[model samples]
Each structure stands twice: as structure tokens, then as C-alpha cells.
Target chain A: MLEYQDYILTEFNIVLLSSIAILIFLIVLLIFEASKIRSKFGMEEEDIEHRLDLLRHLVGAGKAYLFIADKEGAVVDINPDIQSLMGLEPNQLYGKDLGIFTEDTPGSNVESLWQVLRDKKLPFHLQLRGAWKNGEEFMETAEIRPLLAENSIVGFVVSRIGSTDGEGQSAEGSEELEKAYAKEQVIVESIGDGVIVTDAVADIVMMNKAAREILDTQESEIGKSIYEILQLEDENSAMLLPQYHPLAEALEDERRVMSRSYYIVRNDFTRISLAVTASPVIVDDGIVGGVIVFRDITKEKDIDRAKTEFVSLASHQLRTPLTTISWYTELLSGAGSDNLTDEQRNYLDVIYDGNQRMIGLVNALLNVSRLELGTFIIEPEPTKVQDLIMSVLRDVQPSVEEKQHEIAFNSEEEMPEINLDPRLMRMIIQNLLTNAIKYTPDKGKITIDLSRHYPDLILKVSDNGFGIPINQQDRIFTKLFRADNVLSKNTEGTGLGLYIVKSVLDRAGGNIWFESEEGKGTTFYVTIPLEGMKAKSGTKTLS
Target chain B: MMPKILVVEDMEAIRQAITAALAKAGYNVLQAKDGAEGLEIAFLEHPELILVDIIMPEVDGIEMVKRLRDDDWGKTASVMMLTNVEDSDKIVAVQKYHVYDYLVKSNWELDDVVEHIKNKLKAATEENS
Candidate 1:
């Protein structure tokens, strides 16, 4: 019996030893698994840190803030740069919601976008007016990129790039803007014509390289008042007042202003004729700044002067011969040569007529040269429009009687004396009336109506004559252009009368237009400002 | 006696034509081819009226008028400017010398010029009376 008990005790000891060994093996397996899981979590943390470092490197020295949040947008970690850019403590941002730093923009909700990112694990961008703990705000462009772990979103990396005071852009957006700005700089610097940009008060904001060279200015002239720096003179070499500056006019009127008479004096005391145009920059219906484009036109002016001198000389040479013909023809037609036969008299009459036509042609050509050269002077005097018209009527009465046309003169009562160049006014009236009488059939109705329309003196010359053809009406005002109907009807017109009239009116800031039909008569409408011709000081008056 | 008139012109045809016309109109006429010769005859003869041409050799019409006005009688002398070229400088300059009329030669007929001179002489006589 004692031997049987010993065997049982030995079996029990072997079984107990095997069971303890199995428990020990299980504990060792659990320890190894736990250690592997801890190592995997450590790798994910290291990956997030590496990504944060990469984001920091990407932002460079830009005013940027980077932070990492959990998948639910709960702030997990932030860079220290947030303090300098956003005036925020990095520690305070930790454990807070990302919504604390960002506000929803119009048309887009940060919470909805964050929800979308969390659900779809996709990256998104938003513009934010970032709010600080003390209620201060900054505009920022924010990008939220999802952090992933093993094919599932783990967290988000939020980077905000913005200005501390004004509007801000994303890192990529800022880079693009810099590139565009550099391109603009290159274009402005490379232009050959002088360009100057001025602020609202006429202070120089930027000047291109060509502008600097033309003005003999240096880089340090920026920010100075443009009027003070740019010394200008008129065509007469008189000092150009600041009030007359094209830039001043452009800014005040908010319209483009152009003038070819401006002469800019450089710092070296040399003068250059400039054709300048100034335009106002308008933003949101308000004038913000101005831009001036100018170029040197001294050589052109010299060539133009030479052309005018040649025309003057040629006209003088031509007039001497014409005057001799006129005097001798008059002498031969007089009673002192009464012995001439009828046929001889008729031949003399024809010579006289041809000579008169030649004189008229020469005069017309001379007037055209003066008009085209822009050398005609405008001398304004206060004169009654009615009296001037009456005098013109008397002068043209002989023609009126010859044509047997009815002249209907209708004028506004109490017409005041308007400031106008009398010679130019006479030219305007004579051309219109004679054209009316010449083109109209004998005894056709010619009407002259003069009235005041406040800012303008309106004149309408209507003729029941051969009307201008519809197809050729548009070219009527062109120099040396005669309507086909007029060309067919009369051979006496120089085709320059209307051109001269239009040029005179244009120089005086007036307008001209006509209404005509194929069979019906034509009415010409002219509007001259009541204040009269713009007084211009020039060298020669229109002949 | 017929009114004495002086014709000064550089162009021979124009000067003779004007002289012949003036003589036919019953005015005693004096002729000079240029302003220098015209001034010599004017200061010596003291004609009643002087018709001066603007562009001439040696002395221009304006310079002749300037020197003529230096004499006591020349200040009020009847003078008319005959010019084919419409020069503003000469026109403006002649205003200071009391020129009676500025006639663009091509624009006026011989009869009109004669009539203008007759009317001008009559007006001067009336003013003198």
C-alpha cells in the first residue's frame, strides 16, 4: 500500500510541472505581443513628427502657423511659430478644438469641411479670419491635410499662412503673386516710352526706367509731389502752372487728358517736347491714382515746322503771280481799253473768270495747309452773333440775288454777344450760306436759324437744293471729299470748305453733323459753346 | 489840281499797272520799283497819298513807313498798304504807323481800289476842313 501512494504522488508532481510550464509560455507570448504593439504606436508618432518637420520646411520664413489635430479636429500639437504669427501660446492651443483658432468664411463652413475631411480622409483648403484668445483677428489661408495610419485617417495637419494686419494668401498663392509682381516690374522697366504712376494727391508712386532717363531723375524722386518734380512749360516757353497739368486734370475730372503742347524741362535745363496722355485709375467708382504716358516729340515738331515754312514760302510765291494777273486783267477790262471788240471782251471775261478761279484755289490750298499744320490762331472777341450774321447776309446778298433763292433768316430775339473769333465765325457762316445758295436749284428755299441752347449756340442751315446722296454722307467731312451728288451738280466747290469749317469747329471744341436724303433737302446742324471759341494763342490767323 | 499819288512796287508790271490806273483816274502818279526809290521820291515830292508794297528790295514797306513817320507831315499822310501775301507781322506793324487801309491786292479790283482812294481823299479833305 505505501508503494501505491508513492506512484500517485510522482504522477501528480509531473502533471503540475507541465501545467506551470504552459502558463509560463503563455505569459511570455503576451509580453512579446504587447511590446510589438507599443513599437507600432511609436512609429506612427515618429511619422507625424516627420510630416510636421516637412510642413515647417515648406512654409520657410512665411508668416505661417502649423498644428496637428486628431481626427475629430481636436488640437494635439502645434509649432512655436504660432506665437510670433498669431500672438498665441502653443501650450494654450494644445487640447483645444481647431475651431477656436479659425472662423467660418462666407459660403463655406469650417466645421462642415472638417467633417468632410474626417469622413472622406481628403485634404481641403479654406480662408479664415483667424481669431486669437483676446478677440484679435487676422486673415489667413488655411490648409488641412489628413494624417493617415494604415489606410485610415488618424489626424490632421492644419497650416495657416496669413498677414498679421491685412489680407493674406496661402504659401503657393503668395509664390504666384510674387512671380506676377516680378513680371510686371520687368515689363514696366523695359518699356521705351516714359511712364509715371502717381497717387491720388499727385505724388509720384512709381516711375519706370525710361521715365527716369527722360526726366533726368533718380530713384530717390519717388514719393515727391509729381507737379513739383516735373517742371513743365507751354508752347510759348511760359511756365506751365500746376493747375494746368494733365495729371491734375485727369485726377480732377476722372477722365483721360491729352496734350501735345507740353514741354518738359529736365534737371539739366534742357527742354523736350512731349506728347503726353494721362489717365485716371478708377477703383470701385472712385479715382484712386493716375498714370501718365509720354514720349519725346521734338524731332516731329522740327519736321512739322519745316513743312509749315515750306508751305508759307510756296503760298507767297504763288500769290505774287496771281496778284499780277488780277491787276492786268482788271486794267484790260476797264473803259481805257474800250476799243476791244465784243469777241475780245468775251475772251477777256473768260480770262478774268479763270484768273479768279485760280486765286480761289490758291487761297483754299493755303487755308488747308494752315489748318493741317495746327498753326492757325484763335483770337476771341465779344461780338453779337446776330450782327455778325446780318453782316454776312449783306455780303452774300449779291449771290443770293443772282441765284434768285429765298433767304429765310430766323434768329432768337435778344441774342447776346458771344465770345467768338469773328473771322472764324464769318468763315463758318459764309461757307454754309454760299454752299446752300450754290447747291440749291435757282429759287430754292434756304433757311438759316440761329438760337441759343444755354451751353451751346445752335445754327441750322437747311437747303432745298440737291441733297447729298445717302451712300456718301459719311465721308462728307473728310478733307477734299465732295459728295457724289454735289460733285455731279456743281464744279465750283473746292471740297475744302466743309473740311475747314469742321477743323475750325473742332479746334474750338464744337461739333458738326448733317442730315440729308437722296431727293429731299439737307439740314446742317452746328453747336458752338456759348462761352465761345477756346481762346488759343498762336502765330497765324486763318485766311 | 489832281490829287498826287505815289505807287511803290518791286514788280515792274504791278508798279506800271498801278501807275497807269492811277493816272487814268485823274491822279498825278509817281512810280518807284522798290521801297528805297519810293522813299526818296516821297520825301522830295511829298505826294498826297502813298501806296506801299510790303516785300521789296533794300527797304521793306514797314521800314519805309517807320522812317516816313519821322517827318512832321508823314505822321498824318494818307497811306494804304498793298500786299498780296497776308503777313500778320507786317499787318500788325503797320497799325502803329497810322496806315489808312490794308488792301490784299488780289482781292480788290482796280475800280474798287480807285474808289477807295477817292473816298479816302474826300474823307481826309472833310476832316481837314
Candidate 2:
């Protein structure tokens, strides 16, 4: 019982000691909590004060304008940048409503931006009113952001946004644009030639008075398709292929189509020939429309036709009288008398041949005039090239025998009955063969080759005599253009032979070219297609 | 019997020349100053062969032939066109009358033309026979 009393006393003493220690610890904790409250409420702690100063300094150092709005929408904090930008002291702006930045409008863009952030609380575009450092009012862009605490709005933060597009469109710029537009309108209205504009899809956007008169269109044609408004024909009086439509082609290529000949049929069914130029109105976006300019060329074409007709009529008249003289002379010389001296016979021969040459020249001129006037009718018939070659050989034989030139003709393939104009083909053969014999030296070689080359017939006339001068080769086929070397040698040549040959070949859908070296040789290459000349043969043959 | 041929021409020289050439070739020839006289003689006297010029004073050759071809007698006779003009349209125009041949005067000598006429007449005779 005594030992139990001792143990109970000891345990009671230990419990008392523990109670005191717990009481002291509770008192110290209460003191610490009181000190923390004092520091926060009355005595500003040095570390926190320093940190706030640093933060202010950092905000001031930034290039961007900064501001803070409190929960009640009053300016709670703002850097010096904002104060300078707003032209107000901190005290003046500190308690003012955030609406001051929004021009005081209840629902201005800046206010709306700030209100939107109440839920979103993210940065967005906002335009705010502010004053310059000199107290002048100006507009600026800012990024408004909401300060949030657990999805509830606390305040707003704003920063100025910098941009490269600082110079907005100004009054002077817009005035200049207006003046340019007015000038363009005046030019479009007063120009002498026709001008028409169409959108990318070929809808007519505008047409000038000249265009209206030329196309015989009313303002009702505006917004109609260009193809729908104007009926078009090519220079050949045939409908244009879609790929060749000027506006369509210009729009597609974004390029200019210049001075193309076409005819527009007016409302009265009268056709007006015109030279048209079209350009795409390309902008920063892309090709928007096309501008077409045109001039009437019908009068010019009539003048040209009249000139060709005059030439044709004059040639025919000259030939009729020459023909009478020629036949009468031939009759007097050939059958009436043979008892003349050698000199007299020679004189008669000169007269006869000179008259023949004059007739030949007139005939050539007539052919050229007919071709140029587009009145040369093509009468295609079944033709044997071999027979034609043989006959031409007979006609040119006297010259060949006089020159004594060695000649060889090779037909690599049996020619079928090819469709061709026998008269024109005869001219081709005579011209080429006559040129061959005339230019060749005595005992020189001449080779004629005609062969079928799958859709074409190839004829090569090569001579091993006086070739065309190298420099003048390009001009060899020009009318009356005799080469320098041949010009000095031969005075009898009229130089229309090759020109006629080239024009006829071009019209007949054939090709002709020559390879010549001065003092060496000349080989002419000619290829005529077996077909397709019939369809391509339009009035373009004259052109 | 010698074949009688009618010649129509505007130029006296060409007309007399053709007549002389034909007479030398042993054909009886009748002459007309223009296409009107040619048409009259063509109907009044039935010549075996008729040689006509293209351009004349009162009636051109094309109009004369186009008119004479409407008659039954003018339709059957072997008519040959002898012309100095070489226009292809006029040549094709004269071809519509079913003439025996169309000849360009300058492109042939008188001797060659005589032979050509003889051959065309012979061909026409064979076709008729």
C-alpha cells in the first residue's frame, strides 16, 4: 500500500509538469500570431516593402503602358506609363471609373472588352481613349485582361499593343483615291475608241459610248456575258474558238492580248471589222476583270480591197492588148515568111520573146493581185504530180537545152491522184524548175525529188550552181528581191517567181524553205499536206 | 460537105484573123460583130460549130450563152469559147453552158488552136455518132 501511494504521487507530479509545458507553448503561439497581424496591419515589413518597390520599378521600366482596375471598377494600380499616356496624376486617376479609358460610353468597345473578361478572364483586342503627354486626346489599341481569383473577377489589366500598321487610312489618302476614280471615269467616258470592261467570269461590267456604238448595245447589256452581248467572228468570218476569245484568254493568262483582228456583228446584221486589245485588271487579290479596247477597221479594209481591185483591173487590161500584139507577131513570123536574113530572124525572135516575157510578167502580176485580193478561187481536182512534172519539164526544156545542165528526177513513190489546184500546182512546178535551170551553170547537176511522206507530199528541188548569197537568203522569197550576186548577172528576172511560189504554198497549207550557200548550191524543201487545206482556207488566205 | 462555123467577136482584127485561120483550115465561116448578132446567126443558121468571144459590146458572151442555152437548137450545137480574158470565174461561168471547150486566146498559138479545134470537133462528132 505504501509503494502504490509512492507511484501514484510520482505519476501525478509528471502530469502537472506536462500541463505547464503545454500552457507555455500555447502562450508563445498566440504571441507569434499577434505579431504577424501587427506586421500586416500597422508595421510594414521591410522585405515585403522592398518587393513591392521592385515590382513598381519593374512595371515602370516596361515599354508597354500598364494599368490595374479593382473589383469595384476603380483604378486601383497603375504604372507611370499609364499616368503619362492618360495625362493625369496618380491621385487624379486612381479612384476614377475604368470607363474613362472607354470614352465614358456605357457600352464602348473597351468597356465591352473588359466586361467580356468577367467570364473569360483572358486577353483580347480593345480600343481605348487616352491623352498624349501634352494632354491631347488620341486613340490607341490595348490588350485588356481580367484578374481572376477562382473564376471570380478581381480586376482588369491592360497593356498597349504595338503594330506596323501605325498609319491608318487618312482623309487625304481617301480623297486621292476618289480623284483617281473620277479621272478614270472621265477618261472612260470621253475616249474616242471603244472600251469595254468585263469581270473575270466575262460579265460585262462597263461599256463606253464608243463601245456601245460599235457593238450596237444598250446599257441593258451590262451584267450580261461578253459572249452573249457581242456576236464575234474571226478575221476569216468564222466563229472564234473558245480558246481564242480575247477576254476569256486574257483572264485565263492574266496577260494582254494586243491588236487581234475580229469582226463584231451589230444589231442590224452589219459586220464591223475591229482591231481589239484586251488586258486583265490584276490586283493584289488576283485577276478581277478584263479591259478591252477596240477600233473599227472596216473602212481601212475597204480601201485595201479597192486598191487590190485596181491593180487586178489594170493588169487584165494591159494583158489583153499584149495578147493581140503577141499572136499577130507570131502569125507574121511563124507561117507568113521565112526568107529573111539571119539578123532579121534574130530580130523577130527578140521581139517575139520580149513580148512573151511582158505577157509572163503581166500574168504573174495578175496572179499576185488575185491572190492578194482573196479572190483566187481554189478548184481542187485529181492531180498526177508525175504528169505535171513531165509537162513542166517540157516547157522549161528550151532553157535546159540551152544551158546543157545535167538533170535527174527521182520519184521515190508512185503518186496517187492528189487533190490540188492544177493551175496553182503548175505554177509551183514551173517556178521551181525554171529557177533551177536559170540559176544553174552549164554541166552542173539539178535533182528533183517527189515522194509521199505520210500525210504530206515532199518535193525537193536541189541545184548545184549559183546558190543564193548567204546574207540575202532570208529575202530570197520577197517580191522583186533579187540577190546581190544574181542581180548583177541576170537582168531578165522579175523576182516574183519565188514570192508567188511561197504565197501559193502558204495558202495551200504547204511549206517551203531553202538551204543555200553562195557559189555552192541551193536545195529547196517543200512539203504539202495531203488534206486540211480545204477547211483552213478562209479569207485568211489573203492575209 | 464542109462544116460551116460561126465566129462572134468584137475586135475586127481578131474576128478577121480567126476567120482567115479557119478559112485556111478549109471550114466555111460566118462572121458576127457582137454576141447579139452571134445569137441571131446561131438560131437563124444551124452551124455545126460556133466559136464565140467572151466580152462584146451589146451582149457579153456569158449572158448570150446563158440565153441561147434556153433554146433547143442552141443546147445541142457544139459551141467553143475563144476568149482573151483568163479570169477563172468567167471560165467557170462559160462552162455552165456545156460548151465544147473554153480556150484562153493568149495561152495558145493560132496553129495550135486550129489543131485543138479540129480535135474538139472530132471528139464531138464521135460523141454524137
Candidate 3:
């Protein structure tokens, strides 16, 4: 029985060994075949590279620019056209990060996108904001495709298809290049947002499907001036002046222009609101053309208008009850208090206090709502900041005295009255002062300093109060967000003061920042341009 | 003679509160429940100052003011807009008709309103002199 089992085991081993040998032989054959196929592909890649070199040489004599980057996004080579466009010497950009030539656009992570495409070995088209070495801004559509060899990515060919040096190129060379890029027109057609590409003279060169659909144009709009086809108008349906036209501004200034307040009158005699972004396609340090991207925002405008109306109605309803409560509370506190007991009087006082808090919240809500609605008007006039601050201080003198806080006011001796919205300034000053008075403990020191710093007037407010908690400081400017330290110490804060101040400053092209140390103190710095606030015509003013 | 002021607020509580406060401040105060009654009283009595609410039943404050401006006696009459609607269009509209002051009612207390009226009337009196 043992010999029989041994024979069976030996037979099984021989069978398994033969199977393994055969499998190894097959694997070696497959590897050999793969290498052979790889070599064939390598030869074809060399042929394609030669052809590309020939093509690049041919295109070098034209107006177009060509840029090449390695797999890791380092610039490998750039044609002479690109050299002149970027104002760089020959071979100067080699080994440098290709991102240096690109501007950082909001909401796009170019680094991660490149990493993703490199890993996937995929081709992608991107709307690139290209920057010249001389700090000139331009826009272009860039096609980045992986240079593949033996089924692996080796490098990238970054090609942009647009006439850069407009009139200098041979017509034959440009026509050949245009024909080569005809296939890419499918990509532009597939984009959802409306796109209109124009030439240096603001004449339309290409209009995408979405653009035609949005503009309600059935006939081809090609060769027509973009201004004539777009017919962008203001809110009052008045035709936008040449200076106000975003595309014109982009081409003339060679900078990006964005506007959400533009309306386009369609062939159907209907007007639609548009959120438009126009960027100049600059090349060779010259304004070549512009690319205008627009989207219909009629629905968004409608929704915003409805929300504003709702808030307006709600505020009116809210204020009516608030007014009743406050006025009645006043009457009771003034005359009816003579017949009330001490505890009853205290309850009345509490009611009045609560009502006042509600009123404050309502006022803050109205201001925030107006700001969000874009209905907050800024009407600038020459105003003395010192006098405004003094008046606000006078109003809050009782509160300051009640808190026993020492106040100091300092200013430059020859401070000139600057153009500013007095009412808005008063609101900002009142909020800052009230916050300082309310947050600081008895006998805390508060200081106010006003000084000029060339293009800006700086106003500094410092308070030796319970400073913001370190962890909660980042959220202080967020709407209705109070710091943890302040929340525990004081319940009077509506948490809207800093937010309102920030929003107002942002709209007026001013800035506000703060330095705070937990358990130490807080200082807020505000800067407004000396050139003054631009007057914005809107339906309401911030209360 | 006490300077008369008309209170044309739709809210009874607000009207009575302002009227009582104004009376206490040594002014003869006439009360109206709505803009219609206020206009009738305003035309009949010709108060020195008319405190009108913007949003009211039947005839609104703006319409009332517009009609008031059509009359010679009411054209230059002092009208203080006392309402919760802080609309710029409404304010501009009232300004064209010469609204003496535009006050959002919730922002003022009974005492402050009385004080404001006293100051406004004093100024008008001085202007006349």
C-alpha cells in the first residue's frame, strides 16, 4: 500500500512540474511578444516625433506659439513665438515649472488637475489664464495631450490655437494651422456655457452652440462685431457705452472683466440677465483678441428679487410689533411706573430691555438683508471723520461712563475731510465703540486713532477687554458668530456687528482686520481709500 | 397756542402712544386710525405737523401725501413720515412732496419722537420768524 501511494504522489508531482514549466514558457513568450510590440510602437513614436518636429518647424514661421512640457510639468521646449510672447530668452524657460506661465484662477486647483491627468495619461482642454513675464494678463484655450510611447506617458504637448501675432503670419501657414485645429471645434461646441471668441478688432471669430442658443441667434453670427451681436444693456435697458462694455474693456485694458449686472437684448426683443466674464486673449505682449463667457442668470435674478421683496415685507411686519412693544414699554416705564411695585417695575424694565434687544436684532437683520440683496446704497460726500466719531461718541457717552471705561481719541493734526458716506461711517463707528464699551470690564482702557497712510486712511480701535478665544477667533467675522469668550462673559452681543462692518467695508473697497490675544485684549484696524467710496445707486441704505 | 400735530398711524397702540407723548410735551395732538381719516383731519384742522405711517388701510401715506400736495394749504404743510418701511423710493417720492422728516418708527421711542417734533416745530417757527 505504501508503494502504491508513493507512485501516485510521484505521478502528481511530475504532472504539476510539467504544468509549471509550460506556464513559465508561455509567460516568457508573452513577455517577448510584448517587448516586440513595444519596440514597434517606439519606432512609430519616433516617426510621429519627427513629423511633429517638421510640423513645429513649419509653424515656427507663423504667428502661433507652441510649448512643450515633460511628464512632471517642467517646461521642456518653447517655440520662438512663445519666447517673444512671454518676453523670455531662448531656452530660458527650460526645466522651470510650467505653472509660472499660468495665472491662478479662483476655484481651479491646477496642480492637482495636472497630477490627475498625468496619472491617468489623459488629454484635457483648459481655459488658461496665461501671464506674460512683463505681468501682462491674457486668456487662451490650451490643449494638453500626453506624449505616449510603448503604452506609457513620456511627455506632454501643450498647444494653443489662436492667432497671437495677428497680421505678421503668412496666410497660407495660418490656414493650414486653422484646418489642423478644425477637429477641436467639437470641444467648443460641447461646452454648456456660452462662449464667444473675437479678434483684435472686437469682431466675432467663433460663436459656440450654447452662445448661439443663449443669444437666440439662428443665423451664423460669425464675422459680426461682438458688440453688435451681444447688445449688452444696463439695468435700465440702456445700451452699454463702449467704455462699459466688458469685452471692449477686456480687449482695451488687456485684463479680465466680469459683470453680473449686464443684460443682453435678444432678436426676439426679450432681455435676459447675464453673468458675463470677458478676458483678453493677449499674445506677444500685445492685445490679440478676447474670449467672452456668459450664462443666463434670469432665474437667479428673479429668485433674488423675490427674496428681497420677502425680506422687505417680513421686516415691515417684524418692525410693527417691535414698534408697539417698544413704544408701549416706554409709556409704561415713563408714566405707569408710578403705580407699580418694585418687583413689577423690575419686570417692566426687563421687558423694555428685551424689547430693545429685539429692536437691535431687527436693525441688524435689516442691514444684513439689504447688503445681501445688493440694495444697500452708498452715497459718498465730503465728510469729517473726526466730527462723525465725536458725534457718535457723544451719543454713547452715557454708556461709556456707565461702564467706567476710559476713552482716548487721537488723530493727525491736518487730517483732511475725505469723501465717504456719513451714515455708513456713523454705523461703523457706533458699532465699534458700542462693542468696546460693552465688552470691556469696568475701568478698561479704550483707544481710537485716526491717521493717513497715503492711498488709505487708517482707523484703529483698541480695547483692553476680554479678548477673543484663540480657537474661536477665526469665526468672529462670520455672520451671527460670537467668540466663546464674549458669549460666556456678555449676552448683549448680537454677533452681527463685525459681520456688518466687514460687509460694508468690502462693498466700499475698504478693509478690516483684527489682532486678538486670549485674556489680553483686541485691536481692530480699518482702512478706507482716500480716493473715497464709489457711490452705488441701490434701492435701500443700511440702517 | 399749542402747535397741533396729526398722528396718522394705522396701529392704534402706536397712534395713542405718540398722541399721549405729544400731549405730555405740550402739543395738541389729533389721532387718526388710517390715512383717510388722517387726510380728512389734516384738511379740516390743518395741523402744524402731520405724523403719517407709510403702510396704512384704504389710502396709504404716500398717496395721501400726494393728494395733500395738490392742495394749496397742504402743499407746504409739514409732514413727518413715521413708518416701518425704510424704502429709498418711498423716501425719494415723499421728499419731492416735501416730507419734513423720514423716521423709521421702530427706531424711535415715545420720548424721542416727542423731542424730535418739538425741535422740528421750533425750527419751523424760527424759520417763519
TM-scores, all models, native as reference = 0.73, 0.69, 0.68
lDDT per residue, candidate 2, A49-111, as tens digits?
A: 433433342244332335667667788667553454346788987888977776533445555
Residue A383, model 1: Cα distance from true site in angstroms: 3.0
Number of colliding residue pairs in each model:
0, 0, 0
- Model 3 clash pairs? none
After superposing candidate 1, which stretches have Cα over 4 Å from the reference? Answer: A1-176, A238-243, A283-288, A369-377, A469-475, A508-511, A531-534
DockQ metric, candidate 2: 0.24
Question: Judged by TM-score relative to the true structure, which candidate is superior, 2 or 3?
Answer: 2
Ranked candidates (lDDT, high to low): 3, 1, 2
Better of 1 and 2 by lDDT: 1
DockQ metric, candidate 1: 0.53
lDDT of 2 at A277: 89
Per-residue lDDT tens digits for candidate 3, residues B16-90, read 888888888888989988888988999999999999899998999999999999998999999999999887999
**Most accurate candidate by TM-score:** 1
Clashes of 3: 0
Q: List ranges where model 3 is wrong by over 4 Å.
A: A1-183, A198-203, A223-228, A234-259, A278-290, A439-443, A466-478, A481-485, A517-520, B123-129
- Residues B7-35, candidate 1: write the lDDT tens digits: 98999888888887888889999998888
Query: Who is ahead in DockQ, 1 or 3?
Result: 3
Q: State the lDDT of candidate 1 residue by residue for A1-543, as single tens digits.
A: 656444533432343334334434544554455446458666565554555443443333232336677767788766543444356766767788877767787888878987888776777888755644345454556777776767677677766433222222233466777789999988988899998888888998888988888888777378898788776788678987888899999999989999888898888988999999999999999887899998889999889878867876787778878878888878888866779888988998888888888777777777877776666788889988778788989998998999899999999998888899999998898888888888888988999999989899999999988888888888888888988777777888788899989988998988899998766788999999998889876556776
Q: Which stretches of candidate 2 lie over 4 Å from their true place?
A: A1-171, A174-192, A195-209, A218-223, A234-238, A244-261, A277-292, A535-543
State the lDDT of candidate 3 residue by residue for A1-543, as single tens digits. 656544533432344334334434544564456546557666455545543553443234232225667767788767554566467886677898777656545766677668768777776666656555656555666666776666677666666544333322333467777777886798888889999999888899999999999999876588898878988998767899876799988888888999898998888888899999999998899887889999999999999888867866687799989988988878887875789888988998899889889888888888888887777899999999999989998999998888888999999998998999999989999988898888888899999999999899999999999888888878889998987777777888788899999999998989998898876788989899999987888988888
Where does candidate 1 chain A have its weakest 10-residue lDDT segment? A162-171
The full ranking of all candidates by TM-score, starting with the best, is 1, 2, 3
